[model samples]
Target: MLYGAQYYRPPFPGRACWRRDLAHMKELGFNCVKHWAVWNWIEREPGCFDFSELDELVALSREYGLQVVINTVPEGAPYWTYEGNEEDLYRTADGQRVAYGGPANLPSGGWPGLCMDKPEFAALVAAFIEETARHFADEPAVIAIDVWNEPHLEPMYDYRSNMLCYCRHSRAAFRAWLKGKYPSLDALNRAWYRTYSSWEQVEPPPRFGTWADMLDWRRFWLDNLAGWLKLRAGAARRGAPGKVVQTHVAYSGILGNRIVGGLGNELGDEFLLAREVDWFGLSSFPKWLMGPDHAYRHLIHNEMVAEAAHGKLFYQVELQGGAGKPGLLGGEVPDAGDVKIWNWNTISAGGKGTVYWQYAPEPAGVESPGFGLTGFAGEDTPRSLAASECAGRLNLPELDAAVRVPAENAVYASRSSDLLTFASERREEMYAGSLSGVFRAAYERGIPVRFLHEDYIGELAEATVRFLYLPLPLVLSERETEHLVRFVERGGTLVSEACPGLYRPDGLLDQEGTALGRLFGLGHREIQGLPDWGMVTACCEDGTVFAGKWYRQLVNPGQDVRVLARFEDGEAAVTERLLGKGRAVWIGTYPSYYHEHGFELDGGGKRDGTRDLLTRFMSLGGYGIIEKVEVPECESSGISLAPVVRLHRLEGEYLLTVVNHLEREARVKVWFREEQAFAGGPGKCLELTVPARDGTCARWSSSRR
Candidate 1:
């Protein structure tokens, strides 16, 4: 199911064509296809409906052992249908109709979005779902339906002239929702910083406000969008019984778009999952616009899969299939093997399924040929053949099943922390895309770390090992603090940055001896800001030199607490102590901020030694397993490479995989965790083995057990 294609043709093609495509897909090892019905396309030919093509497509897919995920088109429903209908088509501050831009914006006009509050729009979607489901429900190939693509606060442009719906419907709904949450408008106004005289006087917060208010407003907008999605999902499920309904959420990354707001996937996904979406779909693009980093790309995709895999197994619904081609923002084209490399990386990172942004290149568009797997002519070119071959090899049942193993270690990052530190104006200059850098550093070194959202910290604590990288201030709620204490008490390693336990969830300053502080053998004091090149030297008790920005305690350590490293000023920078069988390490600086300078002595100097020391400490802490391998240049860039190891039991024989991320030839040295002897092998000693380049299988038998 991880191998699939995205089909963008207008309504179903003929039965013969459908059968041919399905059979071809099966032969190439594709198990699924993402099918879409664009909103504008459906609106174009109103009652002149065509189900022949859809019926045949479904039938053929079923016959060929392929699953179909359908997307409702009407994404850009025609403007004529709702132009004069109501003020519901995204209402602007000055109120004007949103225009639909041909293929670009489709269906809806301009920047405004289709009004979900409009009864007519809901009815239109319901009808489409009902009719579409009726035609294909009997086909075993049909697995699910994507309710919509990415829907955010109206469109981006024309915000002033056409603000979001301030119309009666939205106003009334917001009031009702607020009333249910709060008893009175007075309380609401107090929390929202509103000076409104009455419920009618209540208005959406102005465009400009304090960062705090902006954050809240952004949250409100996400709730609004989620409300709309829930309504649509409910209607669709009612119409299509026994059908899985879902939607795709495009990764805005650090964009802070209102659609995601502060909730990110936590609340947003919870809402969708509650609405009965069978599977979640995420859009992931990891390559930097400026340069390529294979290791970083792998980490980004891995984080995406880990985060999105909260519900049922997630799908990489809009994977980039090719490199940038001639386009508005044209750049270097992806090397021949880029597509295949990224695809396998997606799967290795826990993606249950993947669908390329496009199967064939677009003839004309803002990004015509930049993201398609197949060329415009739809032929199996070299790149296509390579992709096909990779898919064919991975289709083996064993490899597919081997991907289900849960990560051994979990790493937590708060969305709020990511927003505060990584999304700030100085982010690029300070962090320099090092979130992935740290992740890659750990991954390439064979660390089995999985990125997790803070909301899921409790779930992660249940894993073998849990690590939290809190670069920003940690303001914990009473419940969260309790959770942390419990996690540490039960033999977990809690690693935190400086200034943790400084603030409460409500943004009030936490008293010094608060819950987290006493547990970690530290106290919050004045936080000193480190310039980009400032440095603090920490000489470890073990004689290791550590240097970095100094953020937290001028540590006066308590009994039983070990000062692992200290500043040149003799103040502790890294401290470790045991509480029960559990352990805690408090790093009073952010090592993940590789691009920034730390506290120093009057002049600029790089302070990266602390980061290096902490990395080594964690590696030796038994937190993860590490190994090294040499991959030849041909298989190194432009393609994906993954060393997959499958173990049946703690003692059972396992399969090892060395994938080539190239188009033609590749030579690689696969290194795996040294295996200890089992009944069929030597004693408890660990050992490493390599398979020959041309060998399909290699076995290393041990002499004694």
Candidate 2:
């Protein structure tokens, strides 16, 4: 695994530190550095390509034994390339074209505008790529090409202009896309619920509206961006054949917002984009959003990128490296603890490498004061030293020796979920709240859980997925529903919450009632809100009780289904059903809300119970004999918070990592299944007393002595 920071050339005032920066990062255990090939800077004039600066950087990095990842910024073309082609400037919904660094002396002597889907603009991009490839192809230090950066048009935060790049060029491209999808105008009209007589009449929606059209518009750009990436990757491969080519995703489903024009920070379907590139990385800054909730959401983001890689481990790019500038997008500097946990959280989620955003603060820029590994004076800042020390510990041989396996608990995420989740920002309120509460609950209980997008659902059997948890899947297709049923029927445990499979894959309401009733053997009736901050109460026959500020629901359970609990009004609150050799559990109310918001909303008991519920749901898988973990001595030890423990199966061995977030030392024990002792003669009662706010990771094999 690689551990390092992004190395940007220093501004002119401190240009001398460029070489020093590479040297500093090298000594800090960084193996790689990425340089943004700002197209405008590389090609100052039309057809006159200059490789001087790029060539120097590559050669210099090679001297430091640092691998280089070059970003081909076709998304930011030089002004000269747009000469006599200013009409190609990306046009927004309101006909406002983003004009930054215009005419004469370009802003900072660079332009950041290009219509990615345009043929003429694409040719220029190809030329730049080919030239870059020819120049750096033979450079041993240049190891990868970042095929594109951010992959969206400019005026990113200008919400006033509406969603992005609705220029005639993109609209024509989208029309062509519709032609390919619908084949005829009549079919297109039927799908979009429109009366268009020809494909030419179709256009990207003016604004976010109607799931049918919004789906089409989003799908178009998602595919468009991916298609454009494929071309760019091909160009990079042609330019530097066999070099590792990768790209990155920016949108955090929970933390990120839709860019202007409804084209989000990520494509509608990230897997599609991943399919077009060699590998995928994501931008993660826990500070960008707040709370430990961001930590779990960040985990999901990392998992999405990992899934997109199709077995290739993912990376985290642009990690928080400095204190954010004080403003809307900035925040206070992250502490060593936050940085350490952030890195581990992503890695534990299966990231192969991580690159901090920068090695030093910029001498000048919009974000100059915000992000840095060191201060502007080039002195090692507290954060940089902490990052370097952290890097030294991670760039180890053992990391390479271990192979990451899927966790026991897997959450299902699909494109339908994303489409519905991102449809309206308001609709997304439930998404993070639900998943975070569940993830946090599982974390506290030490149940190894991870997110698996629908694309990887077929691998459930091979991954040894014992339990499957779906948190509010609002949409599902027939195929997806069938897959879920088969999974449950094949002896896999299942758990889901409200609105699971209630909507069709196409974003329409599934009016036929229960689309997934056959598996869970249940269907939801009307969901009635409790008036006057009403607290929904649930009591299980097993003597467990939970109450929350949540919605009340009525449910219909089948013959084999057993109602475990009900609302105060006598509606089904939770139910369990047997399917084949397996069982599925359905949670009726928004319990996670009770878990996360309870502390503030006067539902602490519900919050604590939710954690037990996550563990109980998995225990319902009906294992006659199973593994168990116990905190044997915590009360006297002053360890208040439960430790989070996870096991990663590897080739002929497994790695168990435990993070103790508590303030006091605590002894914990793990009893293996089948009374098996730990490998090499360790007893069946595997016990350890972890230090406060510390972590313990050990490699183990199942081969007992």
Candidate 3:
């Protein structure tokens, strides 16, 4: 449970108060501090390395007994690297070259960085990281070295364009990647629908044309970014053997980069990137990025990253310290209450380390006068004091054993489905919304849900997930299809929305041939796409009527399939099938999408029965709410439709974290099952009063103990 804030990066927070700031941070209960090792700032003159300022910073950190994480910023490469290497600069799909200089945050210049596809420039970047790691390898205070910062392609803060690295070097690297993937020129030709005579004739698609080519292009970038991270991490490991190697993404691809034609095209896959590093995490500027709804998105974002880490050590690498916006238009400044809620949310999601973006306000550059825990004069604020209290609680010896992520219900996240949705419709809002809506429905009901990646489906036998949800699953691979059948056969319940496996992994339509037909006992012959905001009503067999938005799947069910619901046209809208010892339930329309829209119009006050519908299906899987929070239904602007309560199963005790989203104090009645009762306790319920817009954590011994 390492707690700290980012402290240095070349020329910020002036050197005059370095000693004082370090001592102050220690007094505030920060056990760790992070510093940037900018490539351009250190290697100003070609190969000659200078570590005077950074060395002093590390020494001061050591003096204050703070562990250090050396963050290497290759994006701020030396001016010399691109002076004679103009060809290595980033280029867009339209053949436009981006100039090299400092990005918004890095005032020292040298931005958009050099292209790693170019071998010569790549070596230089690797050399700088290796050198930086070796420089502080001997220091006991330097506990870890982060190879990359907010890993992404293209320029920072520039989401306007998705096309990146279309230079000659990048094209050559793409060809090499294709060659390795396809095995030969003929296979490449078949996949891309091209008739190339040789590998040299193959070129990365300049524009989106065919689905196969575009998906391959996107997949190539995902792998390429992982390869780039591998290079950086390898260099650091060579320089420092025992030190932890870590890298964090700007955001999870699932939540932030779901747009196929936009940010998704330019960002690295978290799953792939996590495998290349020792520890994986993400930067969360919720206050700056998400306003009143920051807590919900922040918690979900951390959960996604934790899933990406696959049980490995993950963190909130850059929690918002203060104001997040740039320059004169300062972003929302978080208060002491905000700090407590945000910090607890991170810890509840199994974040082992929490570090703010900075310790003091930016002294210069575009981000000046913002993003700091302390004032300009190095004085602590209420937010900083609240952070100290969180640190104290996190460092408790009981915490390591108390806070654990034990989720038995999960929603499926498919990289293939996301890409296919984007390629076919040119927008990812449908898929992204579905995932969000379904997760939100479960979350609001106090269900302990986490995301499950498609690639890890093979681990289902060993997984604890009882209820698996498939949201907007338009495409699924044959491998996934096989495992899903096995999963249902083994007494696991699966609930899926419309159009599951509408497209195969090879970008071919196969509704009848896939496991979807076998498991669900149904297939749709046609899908009628509706206009925006169009509503389609369905009546369930139980006399419950619910509405769905977007398209509707006209189901043609086979024998032995029970029709759970029907559309207005009397077509099967939802069906359930008994497969082996378990069941497969399918909704013929996007109910989750409709449920999401519910939150938008009236803060989820409108009950369309979708929440009850989804939760009822989950009950069949034995994954209902175990520890329920009893609270009145209140309308809210964001995802915090109700009080958020998370129960973690500890060694002998159950640790519960409750977050109140309302403006007024809440007297929450938390009810647990008889098996989950506390040892020698009065009853199955406990009454606790929580302050408005805040949270609290409590623990009790399990009756079994």
Candidate 4:
């Protein structure tokens, strides 16, 4: 594992003490360091390049026995490049050119870099990337090159109205992409519900009335970003030849605006971006960006990135180093305990490496005196000490050999649903909430859950996946719908929430001929908007009454389908049916969303007897369908051992990780099914005691007595 912190970002903690910092990194048990080669700071004049500072840093890093990953910052474009290239400036929907200014992270001005869609500006970016890669191509200390920093529409431009690239070049690119998607111009009009004389008349929608047009526009941008990544990777490889090329998004595009805090943010599609790079990664700052105490939220964030990596090596590229902000408004500086939990969370999620944001805080700029593992005077902090200890633990040979154990249980993630939610509602709160809610419930139950993307839904029948949870699937493509049907017929259990496949992938209503109606063996009726309390109660055959949230959808089950649960009004709320050799359950409302939004706790701060409708169903009669990895409940915490209990295996050896999410210690016994093989063979229970806000890592071999 490459364990280290981002040591430098030019003009901060400058060349004055480069040796001191590099030596300190080695002493802290770090084997790697990352540096940003900001464009504005490097290539100040057109066609003029300077590698003096970078070359010195690389030499010093080699002396300290630390590997370096150089991050190229094209978004920090030089002012000279933008002066005469004013036509290439990023334009908002209103056609206003985004003014050049310094962002918090980039102290040297030239913020909101030139649009890469423009061929002229793109050539310049390619030149900068190739030059940087070539500069360190022969440097042994420079192990990798990060082509793009936080691949998104426009870096650090969070203004909603000013979303990106409404320029002529972007329009041309969109037109070309449309031509490739549709066979003819009339086909485009049919899909987008428009009439156009020629393809030249086509342009991305300036406003969002038509869902189809908006969905196509968003899809084009996602594909465009992926194309940009490919350009940068190609440029880097051309220069460096053999160096590992990588890039990380700010966070998973899967979570959308929940973590990014923007409305209708058009970010890079992680799954597509991952395919263009050698290693995919994400920048995580839970304490500063996300809530300080939501450990479960942090774990889910990392898991989403890992899922998007699609079996490629993933890293925590920018782990939160210290406090969040620059000055007085800074959030909590993570303590040693926070460090331990966060690092373990990354490891358990199968992260190949982790690099903190920086070795020292920003010395100057809007982000001064923040986000450093060390103090202003370069003194080590508790978080740094904890990081060193974690690094030491990861160096163990057992962890090196252990690989992440794939889960049979999965929560479905749909980009079509995400775009639909954004286009219609202008936010991703409901869709994101529903998906995270079900994932959290399974996570709390000690059930290993992975996210199944729409692109890979067809592979489900051949995969080890047994229990599939689909939440708030408002839209589905024909291909996805067919795969879901086939997956159920092949003996995979599927649990889907309300409004499944209400709209086609193009956002056209499929009310009369809905594929989901056939899949669930039901007919859709009018939806009921509960005005009072806004909750729906469903009672199952075993008298288990659970709450359904976000209103109720009325449905009539087919003759072959059985009504598993009914609302208080005696209307069917949940239906189940056997398809081929498997079972499918359909809930009429968003129980997962309600579970996440309105969870109740007892007097002891533990969850009460109340359980979400999905969890209740899982525990009652659904457990048989799921591939079980059982861990006994915690007596003290009154919950599972932790929100995260993952198993990693290497041949006959196993590594079990139990992360304690409680405030107090937790003790739990974990075991696999009788048919599942593990350390000491199958059905062997391992007892673990984990400290509060910490975790335990145990390794066992079948050969051991």
Which of 1 and 4 is ahead in lDDT?
4
Give the root-mean-square deviation of each candidate in angstroms: 5.9, 4.1, 2.6, 3.1
State the lDDT of candidate 4 residue by residue for 476-530, as single tens digits: 7778878888888888788888778989888988886466576888888877787
Model 1 lDDT vs. the true structure?
Answer: 0.53
Query: Model 3: runs farther than 4 Å from truth?
Result: 257-263, 511-513, 599-607, 619-635, 649-652, 668-672, 675-683, 686-688, 702-705
Worst 10 residues of 3 by lDDT: 257-266
Q: Judge candidate 1 at residue 40 and give its lDDT.
A: 50
**lDDT accuracy of residue 391 in candidate 2:** 77
Residue-level lDDT tens digits of model 2 in 127-168: 888778667888888888887665543444444326667877
C-alpha lDDT (0 to 100) for residue 507 of candidate 3: 73
Between the candidate structures 1 and 3, which one is better when assessed by TM-score?
3
Q: TM-score-based ranking, best first?
A: 3, 4, 2, 1
**Residue 226, model 4: Cα distance from true site in angstroms:** 0.4
Per-model C-alpha lDDT, please?
A: 0.53, 0.66, 0.78, 0.78
Worst 10 residues of 1 by lDDT: 256-265
Candidate 2 CA-lDDT value: 0.66
lDDT of 1 at 601: 35
Evaluate residue 556 in candidate 4 and report its C-alpha lDDT on the 0 to 100 scale.
77
Q: lDDT of candidate 3?
A: 0.78
Looking at model 4, residue 665 earns an lDDT score of 76
